[model samples]
Target: MPFPSRPVAKPQLRAHSKYPSIPSPSATYLVPNTSDPVGASLGGVRVVNEGLVGIGRLSGENVDKFGETQGAASGLYITDWAYASGQFSGKFNVLPDRGYGDGSSNYAARLHEVNFTFTPYYGTSVVPQTQVQATYVDSTKFTYQDGATVKFTTGLNPDTVGGVVGARTGSLFGQTVGLATAANGPDGAQESLLSFDAESVHLFPDGSGYVSDEYGTYIARFDATKKITGLTQLPGAAQPNRPANTPNFDSFTAPTTGRRNNQGLEGMSVTPDGARLFALLQSATVQDTNGGQQQTRNHARLFVYDIAGANRENPVAVGEYIVRLPQIDLNSDGSGLDGTAAQSEIIALGPDSFLMLPRDGNGLGKGTTVPILFKSVQLVDFASASNILGQFDNVGQAVSPAGVLTPGVNAAATAEVINMLQQDDLAKFGMNTTIPANSNTLNEKIEGMALVPDLSTEQPNDFFLFVANDNDFQSSDVKMLNAAGQVVSRGDGRLNAGITNDAMYYVWRLTIDAGAKFFRMDVADAP
Candidate 1:
């Protein structure tokens, strides 16, 4: 689509630099566990400086009359990278964000543990591999580790589980407990979520790291064995099915209740020194809007936590900032033809600065191009931004239209980093091939991101940017629906009858002034 109106001559403002000296940026690409139907097992696992790990037992779906095959598991994606002293080791880990592989409805929504392995060769390369490994989902079931084993009904508030008989109610659940399966739609046994919508996992050196989820609070810590040893609940964040009349805690609800269903906390990161932890909401909180689909709010929240040797209960939010994500360019009917951009992942670069991946659903552009809409990464800083948490508390803002980011008001500062969808950029990353467009379309949910040192180069600032996508286990034509399960529209035209979104990975050379601070150490020395 050419510019309708004559556009002013634009000049590149970036200061050209010679960095990210890696000849090849990507390696062994993996697929999600297509075996499970309901739950697309833990989609992605990334432990900085540790060996890459991913495993799947997929049952390929008949995607195209010819092209790639699709998986039947919940359409989800998980990605992880392997590093040593902050350098790529030619392997990475991949997983599907699946629930407790229990053959129940929860399979689609309630995922538990994920089994992944180090992929040395994408097609047939065997550099150094982290054989099939597992990460067990921690127990959020209060007293019992297996939390989703109870029976419940559909459409009912999911929080009721905590108050149920034999549950870890009241005192056991921090004086309150919410439901993790509210968005799951119906009743299910063994449907409990270990980490609600586990989005990204950042493991520490000592066989322990934090896993961030879009729901079930914001973040939690898992032991080397995969047991969730600690948890981090975002302010105003809570589960569903709480006792009737109970207050809504998950503040980022879609209906302006707490958090829009499924849009809770999505991104999390820790400093290279492991002294600080960072997390952000995928979008505004429910107190702000009903859902990101409403397209009314773009002011997302970024919270920082202190994790200097602190276990599960130790990491607490020390500061908060606003990240106004890119707004969608909608049609009169509020639909995006090209796509809509939303913040999916973030990585801490330095003190109050970081890089963000705000992508759109339009997929990569044609002729080996960038996504027409949200497909690039942004560099942002919260150092000079004001903490408006008090402002929202003083006034009913950030939830509805009561108050928004007023012009002239200083918030987080952001700048364009890279247009990942560009075919040229793909080549620059050593892919050397354009993302072929067709019935087997590759437009995907760009969800995972990680930065590592480019040890292969001379510049100390040289590093690798790992970007990943979650196919949501989508196989052919998918019906994009609203909260009501009503068929709202169809997805990628390529999926009219195309390929399965093979959980994919792409790496790029990134020259960051401050090299990535990764905890690349043996598990025994994490502390």
Candidate 2:
């Protein structure tokens, strides 16, 4: 919700009447369609008439005139603004879960098919940057080559079934066997071990399909040669604790690492058949190494890894699930201690069920706020993770206080005035629903999720989630359900009227290939 001012620039003294002169259009500038580097704009937001404005004028030539009117599908290309801001947020490691478009025509070469963005002071402490589009296709046309294929469905409409699309036929990231992390560290220190913002990708009942990093557990190995192939350890980190192992803690600190793969990891969910993997680390442990000036704020953790063989690399931590927050125990009790709450995102629905979106850090250094959806839903059942089945907080039975109230609101005398103003705002954010203060209205700093299935052939685990409110870009909210997590429906006109809240704004990451639904936005005008 940031771009909207276009009617102020006064000071034209001799400003004649309002009817006559109408000739002032020159402001082109869109040459970069090197003939298909992969493109598609078709046209959406091109509002420009650019007429006159004499007297104390102002027109930095309509700044590239919105890519000269998106003609010829457009694929703008230019490169090296320090290599496009050092591939900010870096992602897009290769997509084509099915619908291979990007045949390119150049409307400013699809702004390098934007893989990620939102940190130009977004929400705070920076951290939201990702971009990957170096362009190289030798062997034949579609070339991200090797065997490239990604297909998953659930965009809905007979669209196959459920979701799980993947493809990476080799060349994982900037070459050298692929996967690369460990950047920034010296002073910005978020510490990246082959970095990963939030990605889940799963299809395991044996057909094999995996991808992790809901909070940087970093596991990757789509296999069949698609490249990504390794990194997934934890059956015992090397098995030492003996006694069958269950109580041993030493490292796993920094940026808070525990729960489902610690360090405030945000959102990720996997389980159509895949053994299980749902990590959402959001905060706390932030050790911030080398520079970003000493750190550690709010500590958050939540892990549940267990992918034993055939490409899970080895992953086997089973369960940790820690996110208690009593406003971080009165801001870390001067001498008593209870501090810890960091999680960027998470979403996994099966073998234990899952859904977390913690990030109410008040926008860290300042600004980005709004995401904080933790209605207490973490169902872990990794065989030995010790069964939790339900954590519950259905967001005060689906919101009330005259705002959104659900559970089929019929107002049994306003249900005790909406349960005493939701227990007086859950005691100003320190008494329940897992605790993590910020005035608590739900929203819980979630970054992305789009599930939708439930085509109702008797409700095969029903769904519809949407989520994504990274603080701006029109805020966000959508929820419909079945399979126990009730609710049934909510906003955006009943969430885009159906096929699941359509799409728009910094979704950062969303997957459902095969059935065709690939996403990764953030391109502030490219041409």
Candidate 3:
């Protein structure tokens, strides 16, 4: 019983005083005011004009300097910005996990630097030639920060530092444990000590940052040179600890207690002041899920770390809270619950509040006919939530034993900020929430999110939230590469097929309440 599809309507183009003609592939829509349901739920925050103000895109078949296919971004961060000489220009970075190999071949984790200029149109009376223009800077493969490239392997290795071949260790970051094998690894692929599966990335003012991983559910710090500097491991409860003293990182095999395979830290953020770091799991850990039931993964964990001052290298877990993720209807019908909508990324508004994107696995790139139900950027507040740091940071401890929070434990407060499924908003972009989604439809996996100030003197509180997608390297005409940087064929042989999913980006303009204490850029030109 899927939801009925809405009638496809032509885009309503409007001219603005700033430009005589409307820009192609970009539009300025009405924002949601206090009276709107989404705005009302914000309590005090506001969304300027219908939410979305601009959109940009990158081709799926785009390749890097290494001649390897550039996959969709799993994370995003604005490294620098400026508003001088009557123009707005900025530089940012996008994180792409193990290349087109998925979990089979050994692909290196990398980052793509992009430079762009933005010509914002706040109202219908003001249009510009180009709403948002972006250009590729270059791509860099992550290293041990000691001259060694990190590989994305599914095989396991023993814990030993450098100088030993195949030793499971990082350069400056020493010995690693809980080595496990993924169920989908090739029959025989080389194992390496420098394995990684990058998900979310957050940068500090100095260009150093942390990238959350899916394999170890670990967060590794990187220097300005994009090299690994330090590592922060999660508590035992968040790791996949196998029974019989053996490692089992395979997604198909259930660990005695720990994170489910592939369901590791997907979203992470650091406070603007660089005093704290927040890491969120994609969903519930193995133990938190009621007997491996995916539907019960609604109870996810949010870990807060003290990374201020001396704690930068050795971050301490200060607080852990339960974030009840939303459950959606798998059938798209008004029926029983399906499963938890996995969260992809998060951004800190303050030490006590942040923005989270939780979405379903449907839409354009999924190759499914189901209609998308839920995909949104939500505001989460942990001001009054109970801290379960010490008590639940171990094996056998469950925050919600029966699919609900245990007594005395309080979950974080969440309010919808931007619902990507809104028919009116998607319509303006030539997108929709229809069954058997088309190329023009909204793509699945809106994972990356970054916030920047609007830099307007009159509206000091306004900001732009950039949302991006993870295309899964579904380009029909892209070359696949192996660990040795050699071109290879995809196992499925759909390389030159008809399927093509581009890396999509959507920009939403929002107005935050001054009292909310949202992070603001300190650039000289910033209002």
Candidate 4:
């Protein structure tokens, strides 16, 4: 997959839409705000009466329960995409990073199709009219390099989670992993469940696409029925190289470096033509880090898969590049690591260029001592740099720094289009220097992003950028604990300092003038 070069065009941010500058410092920032337009559309997506097109949501009202989850609100780390739904018109598709259920239960491990009905503003609350759900059929069909077939997600001990369920042998292009063959998880947790920890999904026109995961950096396929049809691994992402550590794999051990644990393949996008699918590593993978801590290793590994038509059943590894993430405020010592960031969501602006969201782990404005800060959605162009596909694709390699193309690592060219950080105006909402109840920013797992069509306008270029967050199906109680029996505090330890998981969903939208202008390249398809 060859990405064409593009003339540099600087992006300008008009003005912050009239949404709430900051969520109420005293209210629960629920998702979808399904009941009314107050929260859902406030400072979010509004179909405006743009010139002659008049294709934006006007004052309107509607009643629909945005969407709901099945389990404890503690795990819905919605790291899916907001990309236009490939199945139907006027619909947008969203996926979730559903954590695999424990060995004792299967409720949390299911995959479902999430879609929303788009309606322009009329007069009342303008929220999606409907929320649809369908069970995703897991794809157990896989052909490995050694001619051995691995039935992914086959019946296995739940206790043994996050293992290399299936992978390529020596014959494949990127399976020369340099790590150990086994997986590492909790003491009793099985290190053998090679199931797909589906983190992000990108769909094609024909209703087919790839679902990426954290387990083995697996790139799996889901059919129109939302069932996983077939699956494969990134060129070098196989068992041995997929750091044995379970969960985030965030902690690396040697040649087996991979996407950090918890922070797996969180963001994925497909070109409009469905020729190339791109996936972003939430953070720098073990192989990409220059032996630095979280803040130091900011290069995000972007993988490109070249496919044909809407059905990307067999995508060839065409290109891979590095996107450097902007660092956040540091702690006094700098060693304690005060800030958090991950390349959670990404959408293609055009071929070789995409919009990515990088945010800290603090749930919105997390601390009273530190000024509240939220996530930033950014657009980057990767046209000029040489492809670093082979260097770190193998196990023994390390990702070079962002600007410098070290001997083994080749740097990718990237230019920032817009940094959402500058657009902050949360002070009015009471989320500035001091934090208060309900005082927060975007949801923590701000992962899902999609370029939805502006049905209001017949113009293809008109579209909306839909960004959503994973509530983690969280509850107000202490849901997790550390080994010493202590509560594990998240983001400044304040849970929006008070926001409840049962709170409603907040769906925001931004109008992209030519969103319909599919990012493309003039060069021939990948070889």
Best by lDDT: 3
Hey, what RMSD does candidate 2 come out at? 25.1
Question: Every model's Cα RMSD, please?
Answer: 13.5, 25.1, 9.7, 12.1
**lDDT tens readout by residue for model 1, 24-61:** 11111011111111100010111121112222223223
lDDT of 4 by residue, 1-527 (tens): 33222222322323344432232211111111111111112111222211111111111011012122321111122222232322212233434343212211111123433333333222222223122222222222221222343212311122212443223222222322111122221122222233344566665546655677664566777675555555656655322343343222212233355555556677777766667788777767655555545555566678888776444667788888877665554432233442335677777655666667776554442333333343555545566545878756654355554323466443443323222222122222222223243423434455666555433323333444445555554433322222222223222212454544322222233444323444322222111
Task: Please report the candidate that would top TM-score against the real structure.
Answer: 3
Record all residue pairs in model 3 with backbone atoms less than 3 Å apart, i.e. clashing: 16-125, 17-125, 30-49, 30-50, 31-48, 31-49, 31-50
Higher-scoring candidate on TM-score, 1 or 4? 1
Q: Model 4, poorest ten-residue lDDT window?
A: 51-60
In model 3, how large is the Cα lDDT of residue 225? Answer: 74
Candidate 2 lDDT, tens digit per residue, 1-527?
11112232322222223211221111111211011101011111001111111001111111111221111100111111111321223222211111111111111111112233222211212121121122221110011122343211110111111231111111233221111121121122221122232233443323234444322234445443333445452222211111122211211222121222223233445544456566544442222111122122322334566764532665565564433221222222233222233433344444543334332233211223322222211112222222221221111111122222223322100000001112222333222222222222223223444333212112222222333323211112222221122222223221111211111222211111221121111123221
- Candidate 1 Cα outliers beyond 4 Å, as residue runs: 1-91, 98-104, 108-177, 180-195, 237-253, 289-293, 331-340, 364-372, 389-403, 406-409, 426-440, 476-495, 515-527
Residue 171 alpha-carbon offset, candidate 3, angstroms: 10
Error of 4 at 122 (Å): 12
Clashes of 3: 7
**Higher-TM-score candidate among 2 and 3?**
3
In candidate 2, position 330 carries an lDDT of: 20
| Cα-based lDDT for every prediction | 0.43, 0.25, 0.67, 0.42
Poorest 10 consecutive residues by lDDT, candidate 3: 19-28
Ranking by lDDT: 3, 1, 4, 2
**TM-score to true structure, per model:** 0.61, 0.24, 0.82, 0.60
